[model samples]
Target: MSKGQITKARILHQAAELFNQQGYAGSSMSDVMDVTGLKKGGIYNHFKTKDELSLAAFDYAIATLAQHHRAVLRQHHHAADRLLGIMAVFSSFIDHPPVAGGCPLMNTAIEADDAHPALKARAQQAMTNLRKLLCHIVDTGIAKGELQPAVDSDVFATILISTIEGAIMISKLYDDPVHLERAIAHLTDYIDEYLRI
Candidate 1:
């Protein structure tokens, strides 16, 4: 990457971490500067507005997450394993994220309520994409005979998405990661019972 590109990338990545950890309100631009070693003009050069940076930061989070998950899923050929691997997004390993930044989607969603429409929309789109991915996975399982033919793929997808977001929300609110375990257990059970046909 060019020097400018690398610097912009660093700013966005660190901004995501700051936003995830301290939230939009709590995380000042100075925090991002501290983390990224970028000056005011350096940041504003890349992101014209805080809202723009916020959106880019969220996309950075999802891009990182998607890259990690795609690598993990590629290790397993079976649809079941791939599906469970996706569920592994909730495992205890995620509790203490290597990034040490919480889930950006959940953080953005909670923090942007009625405050930043652009960020809120981005977060919602991320959730919708996740739901669509789960539905697609379920469809693949069905085609591969891993899931029952009678299954309501849409409902299954909705529940999985609901459970995941709910768990993350509660976990963040309660300052407990155990809620993620509870949510993952439920999602795993659903897959085992209905998708393991």
Candidate 2:
């Protein structure tokens, strides 16, 4: 990569970590500059405004998370195991998070609401993608007779996504991982019920 590209990537990485640790409102360009050790002009060279950096950081975090998902899926072939592997990915996140800022979607969603329409839409799309991943696995299971065909893939996907997001929120607020574990257990059981049918 070019030197300029490397620096911009560094800036984005630092900014994403900060934004994940703190909400968008809590993060500042100066904070990013501080961690990045880049001058105002240097940071602005890649991103015109802190808002631009924030958007870039949000996208960076989501992309990183998606990469992890791909790795987990490749490691586990069974749909339920893949789903559980996803759970493991999130569960391990509580203990050893890739980015220090926390879940970008949860952080951004809680902060943005309707104010940042563009960011809110992006975050919603991330959530939708997550659901689709889960739904795809479950649908595959049904097709293979490993899961019951009577199950509603979309509803299941919705519940799994909601539970995961909600659990992350609770985990953050309570400073405990049990909320996340509960969500995973329920998700596993939800799948188990299908397997038994």
User: Over the stretch 1-197, how does candidate 1's per-residue lDDT look in tens digits?
Assistant: 99989989888778888888888778788888898887888899899988788888888887877776677667866666777887776463356553456666667788998898888888889888877777777788789887787777788877776778788778877888889888888778877775787
Supply the TM-score for candidate 2.
0.93
Computed on alpha carbons, the lDDT of every model, listed in order, comes to 0.78, 0.83
In candidate 2, which residue ranges exceed 4 Å CA deviation? none
Error of 1 at 148 (Å): 0.7
Which stretches of model 1 miss by more than 4 angstroms? 92-94
TM-score for all models, in order of appearance: 0.89, 0.93
List clash counts for every candidate, in order: 0, 2
Whole-model lDDT for model 2 versus the true structure? 0.83
**Which number leads on lDDT?**
2
| Cα RMSD of predicted structure 2 | 1.5
